[model samples]
Target: MVDRPNKPSAIAPAASAPQPTVDIADDNSSITATLPSGENVTVLLHGATVTSWKSGPGAEKKENLWVSEKAVLDGSKPVRGGIPLVFPIFGAPPANHATSKLPQHGFARNLRWEYLGKSTSESTTSGDAGTGPTDNSVKLDFGLYSANLTDEQQDQWPYDFGLVYSVTLSRDTLQTMLNVRNEGQLGFDFQMLLHTYFRIGDIGSTAITGLSGVTYTDKVLNATEHAQAENAVRIAGETDRVYKRIPQSTTSIVEGDKPRFDVVRDNLPDTVVWNPFKEKAAAMADFAPDGDYVHMVCVEAGYVSDWVRLEPGDTWEGGQRLRSLL
Candidate 1:
């Protein structure tokens, strides 16, 4: 004798738009971005560093960036691979380090960044890059301010500054832009580099093109300057060379007859190509395992070998974009 409803329950509401998937979880230490164009990238808040980038379909889907299997994900130390930012100092301590107490590569890679929410191509006008595939792009901004630093951190580098690092994903193309602004009263000089670790199916057969006419300083052989003699730069053993005064050009990393990726830089004048090889690879604990260095290569964009002098209230900008080839 109970009355029963004949109509089914209301259907679920439909979403207004097909938003690209993104997740900020694990206590907000990392972000996973899944683009609509079959691309996925992961960003770590600690260094605002991009640890992984993968694209393509089916068997073509391969990781373009290399991160060590045992990389420290807890932010305790710099991750072994991916793109590590070397800012305010590229190598050893600079002669004019602000408080002269900063670490080897400065504090940019070790400290956490402030995520300034998502940015779209429609909202922004320009970046350090002059051209890009901006339509339907997913952009994220990470910031670091010296004022927010602890007293001890300030003691290491006293100059006030702000860094807005932006990573934009447009389909299969990835762009990273670094914008540094001086907030102090006087000018400061510094060196910087974007150490990019690229993944390879086999490193022994790979050769990089576009450094033939360029001049480089070999780091392994007494830091001597040498004119590149080969059309294709090949790695024999523990290759480490820093090309200086590089012209605006595109460099391609090839596996066999086909290219793996194209590295394009803007305002970055130096290029560093390094691989620890077998002997040195086994000697380091951070590199991990017995022979992991062969699967990765570092083709960095830099402004070192010469210092960059930034005036107060001025900004210094540079960046590099990587696009994987199918």
Candidate 2:
């Protein structure tokens, strides 16, 4: 579905900047704020359920997607943690735990997104521009577009693309842009993940600084016996890995005891740092069932196996930028 570049029929509203409504009880559980020019953000939803994900002033309550907002992508449970946007493919389901059909990180996190409103935009140089749209926050535009895929998502993804997810809260940064549009013509190839579940107050004195030389995929050494960690692999036991290529101008520091989460990315290469920690989080029953594991930490932004090919008219934009330093 990625053939978008022609939206200019009417999206005006950026003069003095007055569009900050964050009161939700119903009315589609609304939210669209902006703080302009320099940027500070806000975006909360309840209908399609995004539920307040702020940024800047030290990015608060951040849950980019993960865990069950409604729980859509099959593989039995899959959502659990936070920052889950694993499109097309991300993990699990070929491990015999495979239900022959669903249950794994698929289904774009259990389908139900449809806010589709709010504006103040800009994008050119072929694409990517902001401070042009406003709900306010220096610049704003919180969009969501999905075409309706259920039936267990056509018996497990047949083919029919067009998933545009835009969460632009501005200033100091909180950008998550993903536009995959290939309206079922015939050019499919997937693999994408944002999976970010970062909250960490202390993971044994956290220290994931910029991922030194990057080259990982050690699912715990591909399941025992082939260990390989050249650098920055510090999370203390039971840390399932999957890092490759990664270096879009790095930065993934996470100091302990509160206030320090700088996971930055841009046109990512691949980075995932999981933590099932105690008996795979008690044999997963919606994970963290009660363990809580120090707070949270998933640091992901992938494109697995070099999968990113959408050419049916084409439109594939990737993102990841969570800058909160305190």
Model 2 whole-model lDDT (C-alpha atoms): 0.57
Worst 10 residues of 1 by lDDT: 122-131
For each candidate in the order shown, give its overall lDDT on alpha carbons: 0.82, 0.57
- Which regions of candidate 1 deviate over 4 angstroms? 1-17, 58-60, 95-100, 122-135
Best by TM-score: 1
Error of 1 at 44 (Å): 0.6
Instruction: Show where candidate 2 strays beyond 4 Å.
Output: 1-35, 38-84, 87-89, 95-115, 119-147, 150-153, 157-166, 175-217, 224-271, 274-298, 301-321, 324-326
Per-residue lDDT tens digits of candidate 1, residues 1-326? 86677867889985443346778977999887776556777889988889988876664557889888778978899888999888878777755556257788778888888888776442223564434323356788889999767798887777889999988876667888899999999788778888899988778889988788889989899889999888799886999999988775578899988988888987888889999999998877788655878888899988887888889999988888888887
Across 136-210, the per-residue lDDT of candidate 2 in tens digits comes to: 432333333434766666666666677767766644456676778887777867777777766665567776766
Provide the lowest-lDDT 10-residue window in model 2: 42-51
